[model samples]
Structure formats: C-alpha cells, structure tokens
Target: MQKTVLNEDHRRSGARMVDFGGWEMPLHYGSQIEEHHAVRRDAGMFDVSHMCVVDITGLDSAAFLRRLIANNIDRLQVAGKALYSAMLNEAGGVIDDLIVYYLDESNYRLVINAGTAAKDLRWMAGRLADWQLAATITQRREGAGALAMIAVQGPNARQKVWQALPDCRSACESLQPFFAARCGDLFIARTGYTGEDGYEITLPAEQASELWTALADTGVQPCGLGARDTLRLEAGMNLYGQDMDENISPLDAGLAWTVDLVAPRDFVGKAALVTRPQQQQFLGLLLKDRGVLRAHQKVVTSQGAGEITSGSFSPTMQQSIALARLPLAAAIGDTVEVAIRDKLLAARVVKPCFVRKGSILV
Candidate 1:
C-alpha cells in the first residue's frame, strides 16, 4: 500500500490507519465525532494526498477538455478558474465527477477520485487517441512524483490557513470561491468538498509533512476519512462510487446541473443523455424514529421501493440522514420506511436535508 508524506505524522498523532484504495490512510485520530465538530466549528485539515492529481497540457488542451468533459469549459474564462464536471461514457453514465482547473489556455489540471485514478486516466487517454487529439497527460500517483493535496475546511478554515501561511495572503486573501492561484510552490485552490470556506493546496509531496505540522501548530486538528464522510454527507456532497458510478447517470445523482446540453457541441454521452427518459431521483431522507441509516437499506414509500445509497448518523443534525435513490414519483415531504436490521424505521423525504453557511436547503 502507498503511504503519504504525512504518514509518520498521522502515526505519531495516534491515528488509526486503514487501507483505502490501496493507500494506507488515517481513518481517525481518536474519535471521529470530535474531528467532525472541530471542522464544523474551528478548522481541521485532511490529508487528501490519495486523490489523483493529473496535469493536462499541450496546444490543444482547452479544445481537448471541452470535448472530454460534460460541462462547458468555456465557462472557465479566467486563468485560475475551476469547473466542476463529469466525464461520461458513451452510455451517458458517469465515469467520474471531477474538479477541473483552467490553469491557462494550454494547460489544465484535474483532481479525480482515488479509487478510479488508473481507470480514469486510461479512459481519457484512449478517448484522446480515438479523437486523434494531441495533448500531454501526466499522472501524479505516488510519493514525490509531483504533488500532494491537503484540504483545510470549516467556518474558520481560511483564517487559520492564512495565519499559518502568510506568504499566500496577497494571492488568496481576496480570492473568490472556485478560484485558485499558484504561489511559489504551493498551488492554492479556494475550493473544498465540505460546505465550508477553505482551500485545497497542491504542493510537492516532500513538503507535505512540514506544512501539516505548521497547520497543526496553528490549532488545526488533523482529520481523517471517517470525519470527512460525515461532514460531506451533512454538507450534501456526493461520494463517487456510492452516490454515483459508471452504471448511473449524473441526472439521477442530483448532478444534472453539472451537465451542459446547450453547448452547441456534442460530447461522448450527449446522444444517450438526450434519448433517455428520467427514471430515478436522488434525494435526502431524515429518519424520524430511531435506528441509524446505512447503505443498501431498503426504503419503502407509498410510491414504490427504493434503496439508500449513502446513509449515516449526521453528527451535525444529530439524526440519521441519507441519500436515497428511488422512483421519481417519490415526492418531498413524503414519509417512508427504511428497513434496518429486523425493524422498519420511519423517515421523511426532503430536498438536500441540510446546507452549511446558513442556507436551509432542506
């Protein structure tokens, strides 16, 4: 298994390690709930080095990406602007949903899910070869190869990071959301999966340990995958394989906004998307009664039956929450029953369930 540059740091901090997508990563420091609250209230840093960082450069980079991703890259006009998009197969199924950074006209960067890194790269390369497009694609998959990523998130996330890395003040202080900049060796992106104001920093892997220590000194708690999962779930972010996959279209995953159908250009899955009738819908569920929600639990509604895709006890909401896939006939404010263990628990269907930063999306 691969180990990140901060592996020793995590070990020294009493992290319980686990194998995640072939990477030995910290699952939790001590308590997952404590880490989750730290991120929600103050600041917490996550070692996201397991995620794949790929650089796409060449004369045809912009044109290449326009055809490759579902979203309109033209929307990213600024140099450091970032786009959230999905790479679809010919069947209109999502291969992966990724964040693409428009570094320049001739260069772009993609942050992809860790588990699908190898397959994603090969898929892109194969498509590029078939299109007869010439673009240089490089993958930074392992230690010191090129870059490492760290996500610092929460209400006070930005303030804490600025205190630790003062040199980034000029470039990041006034940065807008979804914007990024390269400050010396640090590539700071004002983005995160958690619904918080923070940055995702990409830097040389060798420098990751020291940077983690500096952030720790600034009272930033080191978080792990366990806390990240609950936080993202409460924030209404989708997990790649659980919430979506190659067998499912983004439309059913509540990611239709990421698809661009009026670009005046056809992408790989455009025809399939156009012809398919909307069948399933993704939604949030709040357990009204007792019992924790979990993946693969059966959901019985008045309309029909559905399945919970991603479900957990929400640390923030203090209740069991879930993202479920069901028939489109399932309406909001409907009551449903989730089969947990040997009992049926009551739950309420809602839109998104929760949103951070004072947005009551539910």
Candidate 2:
C-alpha cells in the first residue's frame, strides 16, 4: 500500500492505521466518536494527501474543460473561483466527482478522488486525444513539486489555521465559500467535505508535515477516516464509491444540481442524461424505530422498493439517518420501511441534507 507523507506523523500520534483505496490511512487516533465531536464542536484536521491533483494548462484549457465536465465552466470568469462538477462517461454514469479551480483562462486545477486517479487520467487523456485539443495534463501527485492537501474543518477551523499560518489570514480571511486564494506557497480554498466552515489547504509536499504539526499545536484535533465518513454522511455529501460510482447516474445519486443541462454549452454526457431520464429520487431517511441504517439494505416504500446508498448514526442528530434513492413518487413527509435483520423498521423521508454548518437541517 502507498503511504502518504504524514504516515510517520500518524504512527507517532498513535493513530490506528488501515488500508483505504490501497493507501494506508488513519482510522482514528484512539476514539472515533471523540474525533467526530471535535469536528462539530471545535476543529479537526485530516491528512488528505493521498488524493490526486491534476493540472490542465494550454491555450485550449477552457475549451477542453467545457467539454470534459458536466457542469458549465463558463460561470468561472473570476480567477480563484471554484466549481464542483462531475466528469461522466458517455452513458451519463459518473466517472468521478471533482472540484475545479479556475486560476486563469489558460490554467485550471482539478482535485480528484484518491481511488479514481488512474482511471480519471486515462479517460481525460483519451478524450483530449480524440478532441485533438492542445492541452497538457500533468499529475502533481508524485515526484518533484508534488503537492499535499490538509483539510482543517469545523467552526473554528479557519482561526486555527490562521493561528498556524498567520501569513494566510489576511488573504484568505475574506474569501467566500467555494473560492480559493493563493497565499504564497499555499493554495487555501474555502472548501471541505465535512459540511463545516473551513479550508482545504494545498501546499508543497515537504511542507505538509510542518503544517500538520502546527495545526495540532493550535488545538486542532487530528481526525481519521472513521470520523470523516460519519461527518460527510451527516452533511449529506456523497461518497464516491458508496453513494455514486461509474455505474450510477448523478441525477439518481442526488447530484442533479451539479449537472447543468440548462446551459447552451455541450458536455460529455448531456445527451445521455437528457434521454436516459432520472429513474430514482435521492433523499434522506430518518429511522423512526430501533435500527441502524447501512448501505445496500432494501427499502420498502409505497411507490416502489428502493435501497440505501449510504447510511449511518449521525453524531449530531443522535439518530440513525441515511441517504437513499427511492421512487420519484416518494414524498419528503412519507414514511417508509427498511429491511434490517429480517425485520422491517420505520423511517421518515426528508431532504438529503441532515446537517450543515453545525446545525441540524432535518
């Protein structure tokens, strides 16, 4: 398994290590629940260096990205504006969900998921070749000038980050959400997966360890994948492999908002999405009875049978919640039954978001 630059730090901190997408990552330092609470009540940091960073640059960069992603990149007129988009296959299934940063007319940065780096690169290379576009795709995940990412998240996440890197505070303090500002060697983006107000800092690889130590010294708790999963699930964010995958359409995966079909621009899978139609409605489920929701569990609804794509006991809500793809006929206030251990448990349907910004939405 590949180890990140912070592997030794995690070991020194007594983090329980586990294999995740062929990379050895920290499951937790000692208590996953404590780490979860830390993010909600205060601040926490994650060593997300395993993720892939791809840079696209050339005279045709804008044109290339316009055809590559489902979301229209034309909206990104200002430098440092970021867009969350899905790259799809020709059949409308999601190849991967990523964030694109518009640095200039000729350069864009994409941060893709850790597991799909190779596949994403192959697809992008093939597409670029087929289009005969004059764009250069460079992987910044290894060797010289490699970048490392650290996600500091929670209500006090930004302040703690400022405490560590005081130089970045002035430049990034006023940045809006989904926007990024280049602070010297740091690319501080007001973005995170934990559904909290924070920044995902990308900097040179060798500087990651020092920053991690600095954040820790500033009372930022070190969280692991265990807390990260529950936090994102509570925030109603989709996990790539669990909630959506290569075989899953973004529309059915609760990501229709990310797809921009109203724009005049053409993307990779617009035709298929227009023709395929959305078969399922992705929504949230709150367990009304005693049972924990898990993925792949059968859902019995009045409209039709559905399934849980991702579920967990929300630490913030103190109840079992889930994100499921049910029939379009299933309304938000409807009650449904979930199959668990050969027994049916009652659950309430609600919006996909269960929590955001330390507030309960459902």
Candidate 3:
C-alpha cells in the first residue's frame, strides 16, 4: 500500500488507518463526529498529499486545456486563478473532475483525484498526441516524491493557517477565493472541499512533518477521511467515483453549471453533450422520516425511480442528507420514497447544498 508524507504522524496521533485508493490513510482519530464538528465550528487540518498535482507547460498549454476539459479555460485570465472543470470523454461521460490553476500564458497546474490520477494522465497524454499539441505534462512527485499537500478548513481555518506559516501571511493575506499564491516553497490556494473558507497548501515533502506539528500547535484539530466524507456530503460536493464516473455526464452529476455549452469554443464532449438528452436530474434529498440515508438506495418518485449517489448524516444539520439522481420531472418540493433495507422511507427533494461556510442553508 502507498503512504503519504504524514502517514507516520497520523499513526503517532492514534489515527485509525484504512486503505483508500491503494493508499493507507487515516479514517479517523477517535470521535469522527467531533472531527466533523471541528471543521464546521472551528479549524481542522487534513493531510491531502495523496492527491496528484500535475504541471502543464509549453506554448500550446492554454489551447490544449481549452479543448481538453468541459469548462472554458479562457475564463481563467488572471494568474493564480483557478477553474473547476470536468475532463470528459467524447461520449460526454465524465473522466474526472479537477481544479486547474492558471500560472502563466504557457503554464498551468491541475490537481486530480488520487484514484483517477493514472487514468487521467494517460487520457491527457493520448489527447495531446491525437491533437498534436506541444504541451508537456510533468507529474510533480513521480520520482523524488518531493511534494506534500495539506488542507485547513472551516471558520478559523485561515487564521490558524496564517499563524502556522507566519512568513507566508503577507503573500497570501489578500488572496481571493479560487486563487493561489506561492510563498517561498509553499503554494497556498484559497480553496477547499467542505464549503468552508480555507487554504490547501502544497510544500516540500521533507517539511510536511514540521508544518503538521506547527499547525497542531496552533490548536487546529487533525481530521481524517471519515470526517472529510461527511463534511463534503453536507457541503453537497460530489465524490468522483460515487457521484460521477466514466458512465455519467456532468449535466446529470449536479455539475451542469461547470459545463460551458453557450461558448462557441468546441471541447472534447461538446458534440455528445449537445446531442444527448438530459433524462436524469441530480438534486438533494432530506429524509422526512427517520433513518439514515446511504448510497445505492432506491428512490421512488411520482415521476420515476432514482438512486442516491451519496448520502450521510450531516454533522451540522444533525439530519440525514443525500444527493440523488432522479428523473427530469423531479421538482424541488416533490416527495420521494427511498428503499432502505426492507422499508420505504419518505424524503423531500431540495437543493444539493445543505450548508455553506458553517451556515445551514436548508
């Protein structure tokens, strides 16, 4: 099994480890609920070094990415600005969801999910060859394993992160959301998965342990994957394999806003997306009756049957919340029946996002 730079630190802190995407990662550090609350109420840090960071450079980088992903890369005009996009196949199926950072006219950086890193890299290479693009792709940690990534999230997240990296305060203090900046060897991005204001920092692997200790000294709770899952679910963020995959299109994955269909620019999946009918609708569900919701549970609606893509007990709301893929006719106020075990439980359809920046939306 693979391990990140902070694996030993997690073990020392008594974290329960589990295999995730072939990497042994911390599932929780006693009380997953408390960790979830920590991120919602205060500050919490997560070791996210398992994620892949790839740098693309060359004169054709910008043009290459514009044709590669569904979102319009032309929107990223400012350096350090980031754009969230889905790399789709020719059939309009999502290959992976990623965040691309605009570094310069000829350079860009992409952060892809750990599980899909290899496949995504291979697909990117094939596309480059097919298009005859002159972009060069470099996987950051392919050889020396020199990179480490960490995410600090929640209300007090930025404050504690600044305290931990005092020297970087000036460089990133004015950094806006969905933007990034480099301070010394640290690359700090004001982005997160939990719908909270925070930073995702990438630095040298050798300095990761020291940085982790410094952040802990600032009273930032160390969190694990279990809390991360619940937090993202509450925030209505989609998990790559669960909410979407090679078989699902962005239009049906609660990611239609990220797809640029109006722009005249042609992308990889444009033809198929324009031709394919959007039969499925992705929406949020709030269980009206008792019992927790889970993925793959059958959802019955007046229009048609659907399935929950992701579900969990929302720590902030203290209720079961889920993202379900239903028929196009499923409205916001419509009632649905979820088959949980032997019983059919009633649930109400709502917007996917339940919380944002610690504020309960629904």
Candidate 4:
C-alpha cells in the first residue's frame, strides 16, 4: 500500500491505520467521537493527500473543462473561484465528484477522489485526445511544487488557520467562501468536505510537516478518516463510491444541482441525462429507534424498498443517520424501516441531514 508524507506522523500519534483505496491511512487516533467533537468545537486537521490533484493548462483549458465536467465551468470566472462538479460517463452515470479551481483562463486545478485517480486520468486523457487538447497530470514527487493537502475544519477553523499562518491573512481574510488564494508557496482554499468554514491548504510537501506541527501546537486536533466520514455524512455530502458511483447518475444521487444541462454547451453526459428517466432518488434517514445503520442495509418504505448507500452512527446527533436511495414517492417526514442485524428499525425520512459547527440543522 502507498504511504503519505504524514505516515510516520500518524503512526507516532498512535493512529489506527487502515487500507483506504490502496493507501495506508489513519482511521482514527483513539475515540472517533472525541475527534468529531474536536472539529465541531475547536479545529481538526485531516491529511487529504490521498486525493488526486490534476492540473489542466492550455489555450483550450476552459473549453476542455466545460466539455469534461457536468457543471458549467463558465460559472467560475474570477481567479481562485472554485466549483464543485461531477464527471460523468457517456451513460449519464457519475464517474467522480471533484472541485475544479479556476486558477486562470488557461489553467485550472482539479482535486478528485483518491479511489478514482487512475480511471479518472485515463477517462480524461481519452476525452482530451478526441478534443485535440493538450493535457498533463501533475505528479507529487519528492521535490517539486507539490501539494500536501491539510484540511483544517470547524466553526473556528478559519480563526485557527489565520493564527497558525499569519502570512496568509492578507490574502485570505477577505476571501469569499469557496474561493482560494496563492499564499507564497502555499495555496489556501476556503474549502473543505467537513461542512465547516476552513481552508484546504496545499503547499510544498517538504514544508507541510512543519505547518502541520504548528497547527497541532495551536490545539488543532489530528482527526482521521473515521471522524472525516461522519462529519461529511452529517453535512449531507456524498461519498464517491458509496453514495454515488459509475452506476449512478448525479440526478438520482441528490446532486442534480451540480449538473448543468443547460447553458448551451455539451458535456460528456448531458445527452444521456436529458434522454433518460431517473428511477432512484437520494435522501436522508434518521433512525427513530436505538440501532445503527450500515451500508447496503435494505430500506423498506411503504412505496417500495430502497438501499442505504451510506449510513453511520452520527456522533453529533447521537443517533444513527444514513443516506439512502429511495423511490421518488418517498417524501420528507415519512416513516421508514431499515434492516439492521436480525431486526428492522424505524427511521424518519428528512431533508439531507447536516450537523455543522456543533449544531444540527433540522
């Protein structure tokens, strides 16, 4: 399995390591609940270096991206503006969801899910070739302007970040949400997956360890994938392989907002999405009984049955929560039963649940 620059740091901190998408990463340091609270109250750091960062630069970069992603890249006009999009196959199924950073008219940076790196590259390369566009994938080598991504997330996340790196204040203080700035050798983006106000800083790998140590000194807890998963799930964010995959369309994944079927431009999956009928719909499930929800659990609704795509014990809500693909007839405030171990438990179907900054949004 591959290791990141923080492999030793994670090991030293006594983190429980697990194989995530072929990368040996920290699952948790000790108590996942504690880590979850740390992010809600104070600040927490996550090593997101496992994610793939691809750079697209050419005279046709804008046109290439418009054709590549389902969302319209034209929405991203200002420098450092970021747009979240889903890359789709020709069948209108999702390939992966990614954040595209509009660095300039000729250059754009994309951060994609770790599990889809190779396939995403191959797919993009093939698409670029057909468009006669020049494309290159930036590799994170031992010595280069590589990005060692650290996501500092929480309600107080931005405050802690400014305190840790004073030099970044000038550029980041007035930055709008979902915007990024190039701070010397570091690029600080006001973005994160944990549904908090924070920065995902990408800097030289060699210089990252010291910055991480500094963040730690400032009482920013070192969170692992365990907490990260729960946080994102609480935020109603979709996990690539679980919530949506190559077999699912973004429209059915509750991510139709990310798809741009209009705007007079053709994307890879536009044709199929327009012509197809959406069968399943994504939703949030809150367990009304004392039980835990897990992936692949059968969701029984009065309309029919669906399946739990991603489910977990929500630390913040102190209840079991889940994201499931249910029938469109299933409405909010409906009562549903999820199949647990040997028994069925009742759950409430609500709008996609979110717990941000220590408060649950119901």
| Cα lDDT of model 4 by residue, 1-362, tens digit | 98888889999899999999999999999988899889988889999988877888888889899899999999988999999999999999999999999999899999998888889989988898898876555545334666688999988888888889988899998989899999898889999988777899988788878888889888899999999999999999999999999989899999999988768999998999999967888999999999889989999999999999999998888888999999999999999999998888999998886686678886
lDDT of 2 at 62: 94
Per-model TM-score on C-alpha atoms: 0.97, 0.99, 0.99, 0.97
- Candidate 3, 1-362: lDDT as tens digits: 99998999999999999999999999999989999999999999999999999999999999999999999999999999999999999999999999999999899999999999999999999999999989998887556746889999989999998899999999888999999999989999999998889999999899999999999999999999999999999899999999999999999998998999999999999999999957699999999999999999999999989999999888889899999999999999898999999999999999999999989998
Best-to-worst order by lDDT is 2, 3, 1, 4
Task: Give the candidate number with the greatest TM-score.
Answer: 2
Give the poorly placed runs of model 4, Cα more than 4 Å off. Answer: 139-143
Residue 45: error of model 1 in Å? 0.3
Tens digit per residue, CA lDDT, model 2, 23-140: 9999999999999999999999999999999999999999999999999899999999999999999999999999999999999999999999999999999999999999999999
* Number of the candidate with higher lDDT, 1 or 3: 3
Cα lDDT for residue 283, candidate 3: 96
Error of 1 at 250 (Å): 0.6
TM-score of model 1 relative to the true fold? 0.97
Q: What is the lDDT of residue 177 in candidate 1?
A: 94
- Give me the candidate number with maximum lDDT: 2
lDDT of candidate 3 vs native? 0.94
